[model samples]
Target: MAAAAPPHTDHKLGTPILDQPQLQAGGGTAAVTEKARTLDHISDNFSKYLKSAYDDVNKRYDLTTKEGLAKWLVTEQQASQDDVQFFKDGSFDDFIRYYMSGSASVMRPPPPLDDTYPISNYFISSSHNTYLTGNQLSSESSVDAYKNASVLLRGCRCVEVDVWDGEPPSSSSSEDEDETAAPKPKKEKKEKLGLRKRLELRFGRKGSPPPEDQSKPAAASSNQSPDQGADMRIEPWRSNVSTRAEPRVLHGYTLTKDITFRAVCATIRDYAFVTSDLPLIVSLEVHTCPEQQEIMVEIMREYWRGMLVDLPLDSSQNSEEIALPILRDLRKKILVKVKRAHKHPGAADAKPSTLQAPSGEPQRSSSVVSTSTSSSEELPDGTKKPPAPKAKISEALAKLGIYTGGYSFKSLDQPEAKIPTHIFSLSENTLMEVHETQPAALFKHNKHFFMRAYPKGLRLKSSNLNPSRFWRAGVQIVALNWQRWDGGMMQNEAMFAGTAGWVLKPEGYRSTSDEATQKTAIAHHNLDLSIEFLAGQDIPMPPEEDDPKDFKPYVKVELHVEKHEERNAQPIPGGGKSKGGEFKQKTETYRSQNPNFGGEIIKFEGIQGVTEELTFVRYVLSALSSSFSNCNR
Candidate 1:
């Protein structure tokens, strides 16, 4: 049994950083291929199953009438009388069709009941390093992060892209194959500024002002001067500077090849709504120049014009941060979420600037191409910093992000007053640390905001964490490495297979529900669950050579709670003893494929609130070993 972790209070998001995707292993080809085949047949099978179930129910009772359906399906109010009448008039041919089409006559399973909640209130499947198909440093970056389908097809609502400012490497290279390449010297630069100076310059402030200018009145350069018009907007970055080489996608400090943004956008446009009708979020770890930024905006517009969520240009409507819109409000939309600087003093009056590529510009295509726009800065000592490409997000791109803005977060101890209701993304390591020390605090914060926890940097092998823990805390976006197929990925697939990349948050996480009331309701009464163990079929052969007919078998059961506490096991009749007290059955030499357990009943008691939603039971089957007395053995 795991201990229940507490939730925390609300906090705002910090500056946004690069979007990182998860990674994992190349799995057995046969398994993936077989799964793909099964998935292909799902729609047909699902329709048939629904048709059969409905036919059986209708034949057993009158399902075409309002009162009849109400009594039989246990949904009196939801099934409108008119809809029931329509069904009885033979307006619908198949119950499954009507159920899927949202006809009022169908008393479907509750349809994601928490519709009034914001986007932050739901759990969304996401991918890390979405472009990579192998180990981070030496992997290949393909447009298809998901081998079987697009990222969205894989049921990942949030996809990460690494944007840099140079032409991407054409092909992937193996770690050993790249060892002979020449290494660049770290100290090749003749002059370098201190950290403080770099920070000042990075934000567009002078590294060192002239004596005459320094003495002038502080208000003289006020960007917010009354004369400045609404058109004069503050730049997102202090300086149009970038240190990266090109505008391409790749993991940082890795030898992996890169994919062009234009190509990626094309892929997104083609596959946007194939597997899901919900909105798609593009998490950008952007480091690019202004001209390249323009190119990014243009190319994306060309490919995704219709589906992109165009934001309002009106100044008053765009300035304030707000909670995310609900899923239904953003269907088929693509939202780009990236970091923007908070307002600085006099920022309202700052004169905004834009850059246009030089005339007769080179033709741009899905293949890599360079931008003609250029901007550079000069230092006080007559030295020039590397020409960092400057880019200002197009006005169009800025609008779609009205509620999906990005922010960075370091520690909970920091002031959250500046944090906004926008999305907060953090590394899994940071979130796990918070979970360990202040589980309650993290839980509280997630109730009112959107949070994403991704795997840490060191998980180069593309491993995954236990996602259910984060989901329990109301963290909406828990990113996994879709490239690696493992138990975590399997769980992810299982959770989102039939649904559109979104799952309603548990009742405990609902914003409208009171956590205190929920806890109080569960304090006094305990739940009792009885499980029956029947039999096993086609048990695998042991590694040691043994006759299949002579195998001895026993069953064990373990309970898992979404907490840190230890679980106690109950005793079963005719059960064997074990160190962990896990439920176990006495050995039986059953040789047939279908071995019956003789109707063994295992009753569990003392279970309480939310455990049904959070608990998991695992059953194990093993060959029982024989013991011999020392003298008679």
Candidate 2:
């Protein structure tokens, strides 16, 4: 039964294998040779595993052969020479555990930032009703909400402020009087036009020449002489500015409490640039009278000093051909976006009535009234009438809306909607309707200008809509209710993870070509993704009292892609209505604190409509008996 065994030799290396352990385990030369052959077989399986299971790592490191992987582990991963030798000598499980625990296991790295593109081209992290810390209807508004949402969160760049007229001070002390006083502009005089010029303005200069102009030469009639029209001069028509109450921020038309607008401004000034130097967008919902609006403007100007971005009054910037400013140009600036008062055809020529006190009382010359009652009138029943419909947005406040001008959305086809500086705000439901009917139009419009979508009015509980729905259509400012930590907020956090509040959109969304607009889905790039559950080590126990042996671990894997559905487009095969649909798979449950999954592999083949850059894979770890789940993206 014991003929002498043959001496073992390493065939690949062409050397005799004479290790003492091998000699002892084998008990003879023939048994040692058999052991060497088994080691070679195990090494071959490990190489195959690296090529298939860790293909992404192989591609990343440019490794095509097992020898290359071994070299990389030693050189790049800093594995010891002994460890490499052990891997090559049949320690497959040990090598894999080491590699997976290191940096080689990272599936996604931080995305590179390209901030040179126009700000409209990026997805801005935004918050809706930023002052509300609870549900929309009855929440307490506080400045702390702004502090948390903007700086503490580290990425939100856009915040909302709904401003209303605050309660006036009880008595007009010297300090109170100074606070209510509006800063007046320096007066400048200009020469008014004579009758001939006035006639030309009323009619056309081409019409009948004036009696005084008939005697003049044809050249003088066609063009004004140096001193021809300079006859009478008067002060430019100025609005009778009245004293204002303190401006307040709150959720309008709700039971939400108010926070002083000055406090909000102070918070913004202190914390806006704390997390990121990128520009902060203050979306102002002005529900105040003109006087209080001016107070809002003064507060911002005083607090933000040089940081305020002054919007140019140039008409050309509104043209569709022009683009919004790039991020590189707007660093550390505060941009206010408020609804602009629409100018009618002859609005400039219409004379505004002087603001007079009620019942012929003396009007305050300093635009600071002694009491709030000075601005309101007593009704016949001794009750003051509700203040006149919130006055049109004041000129001073309108000027602060640099770059982003809030506009009421009518339709994409409207002329005003084409303005590059105009940001059309839409409710979630309205945006969904538009997406269903005219998705191509929505995508194309967002390419030139910004579109903001907020929660619908029915979201009284402050729930959030899936921002991805609007994001897929190239919507720039998807303002979510920051108070609720739901799936929408999770998705939002994932969207701007690496980038500081601004993420460049996908190429298809940024493209201006008609082909890009027409194509609703990304081209199918076939990829085979294989995920293997190797083992779980040191899994934490549940917080509550539970038996350790009863712990059963499982993982649910979900592949989320951009939902792309074209109206009237043919349905995808396998009863899928969308080209890129969600796919979910889970592993078998195992009962152990540290469970071994036994190398179970799940493969997804022919995945369609997925851009590696935009797609996300979510893994949810949970137990069968417990409702607790931990989601990782």
lDDT of 2 by residue, 302-374 (tens): 7998788864434345323345778788899988988765434675456533322124321112121110111
lDDT, candidate 1, at 370: 26
The per-prediction CA RMSD against the true structure, in angstroms, equals 15.4, 22.0
- Model 1: lDDT of residue 467: 61
The runs of at least 3 residues in candidate 2 whose Cα sits more than 4 Å from the true structure, single-residue gaps closed, are 1-107, 149-152, 169-244, 313-323, 343-391, 511-522, 534-553, 563-581, 588-603, 622-633
- Clash counts per candidate, in order, are 38, 0
Query: For residues 1-633, could you state the per-residue lDDT of candidate 1 as single tens digits?
Result: 001112121010000011221111111111122233221122443455556667777766567665566564445335544445335432225354355443422113325534566777777778888887665545678886643322555457888887765542433555765776776434534137543344333333211222554333344345655654322322232233243223577764345677878678888887767666787888776655443554565566678887875452233333443445676777888877765443446755665333222244323222222222122334334444344333344343343355566555655544332334466777765665566566555666776667888876655656665565566666888787765544345445534544567777767776655663222212223557676655554555443526767776665554433332211111222221111222223334466444666557777776543244444444445564421100000
Best by TM-score: 2
User: Candidates' lDDT values, in order?
Assistant: 0.51, 0.59
Q: What is the lDDT of residue 52 in candidate 2?
A: 61
Judge candidate 2 against the unseen true structure and give its global Cα lDDT, from 0 to 1: 0.59
Count: clashes, candidate 2: 0
